[model samples]
Target: MPLKLYKRGKVWWISGTVHGQAVRESTRTHDKEVAEAIRVKKEAGLVSDHVFGPKATRTFAQAVESYLKAGGDARFIGGLDDGLLCHFYDTPLKDIQQNDLDDAARKLYPTAQPETRNRQCYTPFVAVWNHAVKNGWADVRQWSRPKKPKGTNVVRITKRRAGTFPVEYEHAARFIAAMSPGPAMLMTTLFYTGMRPIELFALEAGEVNVTGRWISLYKTKTGEPRGIPMHEFLVPIFTSLLKRPGLDKEPRLFRTPRGEPYEQIATDEEGRGGGGLKSAINGARRRSGIKDIAPYTGRHSCSTGLVVAGVHPHIKDQILGHAADDMSRHYTHVPQAPLIEAINKLPVPDAWHALPWLEDPLAWSGRLAEGTGRRTDLEKRREA
Candidate 1:
């Protein structure tokens, strides 16, 4: 018999026979709308394969549980889970084919200005299907994704390393100044040091050697602890934050308004989880009237400033934590004095004023919006 939905108390349940064996389960929902969706998914999953016969059928949720449990990097695993499960909840592992996935991609963030479908959508959906097939929990014909159409841009954000561009120093100074204390400090820190936003997020009070005037990152994206000499400009910021009452030597160096640690690159289930720090930058950008400024804009600018200030290439690597401590190669260790001196030489725009959220962001926003904003290839876009 085909699957049938029957009420159990106030909720609903499904029962059916697959390959001559009776299977039954609760929809666990009181609402008609939710129950109907669950009913469809259960029915699809339980139907004995007319072709393959009694092969086991796995629900999308079951496959996802397996994937999350077999963890590697938490961010990648969590990202895939969180991004995919909402779209495919209670879906039958076998029902979705490649064409369906392609259709689903079209609907996500369709109205986004750049038209990038959520690229993260790819992992959970694909990974779950593969895991199910590998484990004998599901058997379905392999499905291949269709070719991406022209002009549909999707950026899959993993842990960030490099940045796309530098915000002009004049624009940066004005933008940072208009932000609140927490974000203004963050923005300045990013610009002066080529630290990845995640690196900053993972920083702690104890890691900062106040007496030695260096910061040690015991946790980093590359699974290595790195030490960076603190810039004189950053000293006051760290000092002020560390002095917050009841904050211990080991507390997170940077925090949000609630005193929770700021977002880090990626820790094993700690910090802001990823988006909080970026959100702060975007929020500050709106208030500062700066267009196209982001958290990463500072890192790019900082590196550029070092290059412009004639810092040696090898020394720059150490300061930015990009140097590899490889076994076979001899690497020159950069000392504190020159690195600090080089950072002090890094240029700041003449327009820097006090960072107190004093400027009207709308004024700067308006100026940019009035055709002063960076334009794409207008002629090429018109042709497209």
Candidate 2:
């Protein structure tokens, strides 16, 4: 084939075979004339390489090393990725066919949810391979990254209700009312801010700005700096928490439940991730007998509450550190008044409308739990 010229994301590229292996490269030009010139040169090079031996092909392992050397691991989130790449470690990128990629996926993620396999396996595999492609070793057009393994028709919506239970605003209020001071405060922050558990743990006292009416943050899993405006109600809470004795000791802001690092409960009982926040949430859920309650439910509850209350989506994204424009919104200077106003519009759940008080949302703690919500006496009796 006369080296096939294609455009990907505005950059023109030439695709063809060199020594029986697929190779493609960006022409770095928008003008078709310029692209055509680049394609001709690439085709000439491909012919030369085909007649002789082609450039040395890189293994998937070397691609991973290049990626890591470029500090890619810090940029994306995933574990068990190295194991996925191990399947093709020794094989040359040029020799890797779609079948080889498929076999790896089927073996490593056979019975894992297709989405899980895609993210945990194929996602990393492509990232590693892309590093090679950028260096003129592999091809994106050849063996494509499998976003979902073959024959997996359904994108299972069994969207894990795992490790968390939803909390309505009133239920949150009651849960807070019933909880110890430390847990109460912690849950309150989660409920209002929709901040992640790790972000909560990473909060420094200096990050909170009562005078500026915003909380600036840099320590996030996304590795992006954020400036979340403080809600009106949270100002007093922040003021109180900021002034509490021994606040200066830890680098992080609110060491609620005092002295213990947030991850202790996560480590001992609740398992890794979310740290003591997860344990504290579960403990409070049990203490209050609030079904399906966990730390993350607080974030969702806050988001749902805002949405239901007719708050602007952009405002919600801003408050929760979610950029609708995906990091671009982070840089746009939005006035605090509008943010606070949108927050004020977020309706608190009435006493009669509170969950657990009114109803139980689903609970899928991911640990093969019983039924979802509350069951009646006759229903329970029938099961017995």
Candidate 3:
């Protein structure tokens, strides 16, 4: 009915089936009392989900599967899960070792960018495994994570182009000014409001209150909708952009040039889907002759800028939909206004200025300008 007891070689064993599957196993105990206790714990786990419901007993896989399925066939399981699944799923959890993790890390090291692979692949798997351990699906001691190599050496650093800010917000006014009318306005909003691009992309026309000087962002990374006070610098610009015809009726405030509503900007089943806004900053960098600055750099520029501007880190994290200050380095809202202010406060290109250029702009520019002839040529052509 529950568990049957047996004795083999002077050791007592308690065995039973779990979830209709035979799960007979040695209790590995010399004492019958110990064997009985083990049997009770295992049997309790088996029926807990049925009697107490899902909150009482779901496996790691079950929970992850549920989370993935809830987003209407769209989900953001960490990239680590994909990497771990690719390399480790074939083996039992107990077999995973430092060597196994190292091999997996090396496999990813050669091909994938550290940040991308770490976030998308490594992080997810660790999270999934930890989730499993938490739910008693796997032993915590058996779980291992790739020992991420320290320092920036392993990373593929894309140098920014000359005359561009090494950091996105270093030349905030100019970056926004250089953007085409549509993207420029959006950039201005992104910089000031520090809203994640997705959160902004997911905005409704009525979400912004021009008079109230605030915007409510739904579907934020935090899984909660937060109303952020619109910076005074952003209100007029967003108001003007929102006033543009044909944009007001869209379900989402942001759209592609072709007028499609913004969707998740990730590669899906059919390959990387439409709405290039996810990589909009890269596109901007290409346009602005900046190199290697990602959409995330905008976010980094925002937080770092706020830090410089003396905005409280907690407040900055709250603004960026980031749960913690340290994790903000991973992904957070980019504050355009403060970042720009920080950039501008850096001594201007001319040496006569009192403030030292936050960095040597010329040196930063020179580093970025390397091997960017096509970019230079394009800029020249545009000026002509």
Candidate 4:
């Protein structure tokens, strides 16, 4: 039987059988003409699916829905779907070719850097397409991604580097000293542990073991659980912060002055995920006169420091949670001595000792702590 349109209250609905499959759904419109059009399209699609198989009828939008239902990370995929949907919404999954993807990338991000285009466009597209492939909705195919120009090692000195800027320990100490206790401790932890900002924001008080001198991260960007050895310099800082009166019952280790968890994660329209510390970090950078520094600077600085200090590549990779071995990841009893030794090699500048938070972290607890007294000499001079 052909699908027939009927009125259910004020809304139009369709019910009947097409291609021997039962179909009953709301057209979700009050207009009879629109409802009739929907019913016809539905009947046609059913007939095509029955004749050509599901792959021929399935759309990219449908595959995206299935991918999301299967627990795909929606941060980037959700935010960036408008352009993708505009290009491929009604297009059959089987009909989407490599050239179509390439055209989509160019049309979506005409002026974006190659890296940005790859990250925002190609990565998410491949992820959804691969998910469809796994479910037998599409054939397996590799989509080409934009690549950076090959390095020739000809000393090309650019004012600004392409990636995360690595701040020196001296500048880092100055920057941390300029902020209040809450943000200062957060930045310090990032530098020492080399953990991603998202991971630090999600850190629970229970995961931090001061006595063991190791912080356990159950969730990471890579979806692997691993441990980070706390630097000796961080020992007193964490010890002080953890011993605060009500922290024993608190779920999150890091919190704002108002005693709320840091906003953890925020997604921009471009589908980038940033930590909640943007304002605090910007304020600190301005005060310290370090225009180039960002929250990710601490992570980059940690990696640079490890390399400069002659830490082994394997040990550095493990500490930075980058492509670690299966044994190191699975074996809970793996020794922490190597990680600890590598982390401790990161330099601690003498200028950090002068920061009041280094001695008494709780002193800068309130909103008032961000006053003139906490400002660096450069900040003070600007005010004067």
The TM-scores of all predictions, comma-separated, are 0.50, 0.56, 0.54, 0.70
1 against 4, candidate with superior lDDT: 4
lDDT, candidate 4, 273-370, per-residue tens: 54556667667666677666666777888999999999988888888888556777774334488788889999888877676656666544433234
Candidate 3 ranges with C-alpha deviation above 4 Å: 1-48, 51-57, 72-82, 85-117, 126-170, 244-249, 266-274, 278-287, 324-384
lDDT per residue (tens digit) for residues 1-384 in model 1: 776778889998877775565868787889867887887766665554443532345556677787656541234333333445656666676676676676666555455333234323454466666667767767756555434456649655544332356756777887765454465666677788777777787676677765555776656554455667677766666766666655564477666534556754442211134446655555555655665666767777877878887889877887787775753123222236766777776666655544322133211211211121352222232356
Q: Could you give the candidate ranking by TM-score, starting with the highest?
A: 4, 2, 3, 1
lDDT of 3 by residue, 262-376 (tens): 5655322121332454354455666566554433445555666677767766667666666433544333233334433332332222212221211232211121121243334
When 1 and 3 are scored with lDDT, the better candidate is 1
Clashes of each: 1, 3, 13, 0
- The parts of candidate 2 lying over 4 Å away from their true place are 1-82, 85-106, 118-166, 245-249, 264-272, 324-335, 349-384
The order of the candidates by lDDT, greatest first, is 4, 2, 1, 3
lDDT of 2 by residue, 1-384 (tens): 567888898888888875566777788888899999878766775676566433344666667777777644422222345465556776777787778777887887788766556656666676676666767776665445555445668554554453243456766676554444455566667777777766777787878888766777766544456767666666666776676555677656555444444542211111235565555555556656764556666677777878887888887887777773455445434337776676665455553233221121111111111221242332343366
Q: All candidates' lDDT scores? A: 0.59, 0.60, 0.51, 0.75
